[model samples]
Target: MQTANNCNFRSSALGPAPLPYHPHHPGLPLALPAPVAAAPALPVPVPVAPVAPLAALPTPPPPPPPPATIVQTLTRHVPVPVLVPKPFPVPVEKLVHVDRPVPVEVPVPRPYPVAYPVEKFIKVDRPYPVHVAVPVPRPYPVPVAIRAHYEPLHHHHHRHHYLHHHHDW
Candidate 1:
């Protein structure tokens, strides 16, 4: 069999090219041809017309108040009374008494001994006297030059000292 690219001839030359002939087995074929039957003839139906148009209706008046019954229209009106609660009473307590036997039992305690101690006298000796040495004064020696220098200064200031001492005026 020839591949697609190898077949260069135009298709119109062979009425649709005979469907590329495929190879079949000598003993068995892949698929057998199926048989077909023609369709049955159907009956033609007659056409139907639409229903007639509805009549124009008159607007109905509101229905009369359901014809009032005698028991409902003549009923009476009554107001119920309010109930007031009552106050509760105060409670009182009760007393009870009981009796029993009494017993008298006294306890006796043991006596403890008292203790007395003996005394002894002790003597202390006095300390002996001690002798301490005292320091004696020594006479200081005077320098003649010092006494002479101070004599002149003392005499020069005698008049100032006397004037300060006398303030009678």
Candidate 2:
């Protein structure tokens, strides 16, 4: 804590060098702070009455808005179709057939199939019913050859319905 002015300035050309105990000098071991005297008590200001808080008028209905704005409200979810006029327009003598669309559901016949495939045309050999003429051998074969000319040959031969030549075997 001793000041440079208190030391003998004979050898050092440098101006007033800080002592190691000086608080602002660098590279010196830190020393505990000197104990300070207790602070004096300060006087607190008195709380004002808050100037009576101005009276707060009723807010004047927001000053009637800068300009008028239209506010529309939606009421109906769906508009129903009206069929006949409110209370029968015609007299009792006149007959009227009328009904509201909302109350009644008119039945309409759906379309019948004009042209539709009953089954798929696959690449299959579909079966078909047909009468088949099969070649069946007779129980006992009997030659049904009718002879045109029943001429008795040199000996005898089978009765055929065709002309026979002598060279025919």
Candidate 3:
């Protein structure tokens, strides 16, 4: 009895235990793996020639009828006044020649006055002699054989300049 109680307690802890395996099931159908289907085939294209537009038909000619004729009568009437050329009066002055030639007095025009003779006197201007004191070109003192050499003059000039400058504070 203790063993049966222990089994029952273990079965209750596992929650009613799993159902026993059966040969036939009545609750649900067995699950099947999903079926893979192939893609559908594409339609084949048909080749066709382009159709041309039809040309327009020519127009029918018009029917002909009868020709027409006209008659006219001509009449003439004379004008009362006919245009005649009339004579012109002759000029007595233009036809006859005169004994004394027609006096044409043409007045003689006076000549233009002669220009006055101009007496031009040239006034002589006495030019005051500008006494420009042109500095007489003094020819450089020609060095002679008897003259002293430049060395002495250069020494003398240096000594003079030194003596003059020495006195300045």
Question: lDDT per model, in order?
Answer: 0.23, 0.28, 0.24
Model with the higher lDDT, candidate 2 or 3: 2
Across residues 23-127, which tens digit of lDDT does each residue of candidate 2 receive?
A: 455455467568997898898999877554455545455565564232221232122222332343233332212221112111111121212222311111112
Highest lDDT against the true fold, candidate: 2
Q: For candidate 1, give the lDDT of residue 39.
A: 85
Tell me the spans in candidate 2 whose CA falls farther than 4 Å from its real position. 1-34, 47-51, 54-61, 66-169
CA-RMSD of model 1: 57.5
Order of the predicted models by lDDT, top scorer first? 2, 3, 1
Better of 1 and 3 by lDDT: 3
Question: Taking the candidates one at a time, how many backbone clashes does each contain?
Answer: 0, 0, 0
Candidate 2, clashing residue pairs?
Answer: none
Q: How far is candidate 2 from the true structure (C-alpha RMSD, Å)?
A: 40.6
Give the runs in model 3 whose Cα sits over 4 Å from its true position.
Answer: 1-37, 54-169
- Give all TM-scores, in the order shown: 0.15, 0.17, 0.11
RMSD (Å) per prediction: 57.5, 40.6, 54.6
Task: Decide which is better by TM-score, 1 or 2.
Answer: 2
